[model samples]
Target: MARAGAVNYLFGTRFYKMAYVEFGNPAAPAVVCVHGLTRNGRDFDALAEALSDRFHVICPDLPGRGKSDWLQDGLAYQPPTYVVALAHLLAQLNKPVSWVGTSLGGICGMMIAAAQNTPIKKLVLNDIGPYIPSASLQRIRDYMLEAPERFGSMADLTQHLREVHAPFGLLSDAEWAHLARFSARQVLDPTGSGKRIAMHYDPKIIDPMRAAVPLDVDMWPVWEMIHAPRLVIRGAESDLLLCETYERMLKEGAEGYVVADAGHAPALMDYESQARIKAFLLEG
Candidate 1:
């Protein structure tokens, strides 16, 4: 079973709420899973359930996404804001936690893990690494900017997700359906129409990203500072985390796993993917 909850925190002078889902007993070892840009905590449903028996798995929707409150200033959507908010979340949990982050979430994890006395005990970066090519950043920015504002129906939304997230690897119809169900929400159409489906996140969240694109994202210094045991998961076909980068990560002492036939990311919805992640996190 999963329980949904929210935490209210002050980001500058404004207060925002971040929503999250929890699985398993709170007394168990904590594992925090964070999603990519344009994705929410629910994306971890299958993975969290798989690990629930042995871990207290927590998946949080970063501010401006899912059930979390959108920031008044779109610029607040950067990694710094997320670091502060997530730090607050960790404080509330009051435990050292293993971290599993995907894409942009992985970047946040890296920043936090690099900090002095971070609570992260183990780190798993999914489909992302310390260095991101400028081309990949530009590609992601274009995709987000060109996304549709509304969909006529859930099927339409599902189709769109399938096309854009083709890199999520091979997911079953049921799995795709699960993604669609949680990826959107019903809202009154702007034209005084009945109702329409909209992406769960705030569109303005892309503001800072638009400003940062076309430039490589470099974080090797941060990566070097992290002393926690690390695991890097990359899609074999992913342009975001190149093979050379993956090899370099391995040489730098981080364990690596490549998900074949996937592109930007490998959704850990499959049994094998979940098992690999589980085994790593459980390692002594």
Candidate 2:
């Protein structure tokens, strides 16, 4: 059920491998998807299938996550490098593409949209914005660092995700199973347990935070600079994207909507959310 491919980007002298999934016709209009922090490209499998008939969907696992190659220098995992890597990915397609970014992914689209002569035609920012609350960042930091290294079974991993990500609103059992299938990779079990499942991403991906200093940067100007049509999907109780910022995004002409009973980030797995995105993309 999974159809993913890899591409290599030569950064300086070394090459980095990026993993992404594609669905639908290549000749159709393209939609480039990016996942949130600690998540891989497979997170968008549902959304990709829903939109595939009308759009060519590309969902990438940012470096250090999913099937993508990990970085030797953790500092290079910043948004700017991601933007460049994505641009290269799209350039290979030789066509402009719409963007759907969630959390850290949204910030990548913002940076690319603000740059000169970019290929982003439309943007979807999911539960994130310029003024990221440091509180949420700290929460993410502590949680990832303390998460269990691996699970004895896929069921165990799914259960862990259920408790930790309950704020993504209620997902059906099938949905959770889908997530668990992609979230872990089979590895040689150290305890000779016959190939236990481990998280798919590099644990060192958070190393940048250890040596980082705090800074507050206003992103109103950059947000304003983007000319493409935008849609902002906010989880009702999201600690990431504030209501005030969502309002400002609306004032700046970006369409806005809320996914009730959700928090932090709304996973676009539900019917209502996919339908809204479909309508926006098809708006006349």
> Model 2, poorest ten-residue lDDT window?
209-218
Per-residue lDDT tens digits of candidate 1, residues 22-129?
A: 999999999999999999999999999999999999999999999999999998798899988898899899899999999988999999999998999999999999
Question: Which regions of candidate 2 are displaced past 4 Å?
Answer: 191-195, 213-217
RMSD of each: 1.1, 1.7
Q: How many residue pairs clash in each candidate?
A: 0, 1
Which portions of model 1 show Cα errors greater than 4 Å? 192-195
Per-prediction TM-score: 0.97, 0.95
- Record all residue pairs in model 1 with backbone atoms less than 3 Å apart, i.e. clashing: none
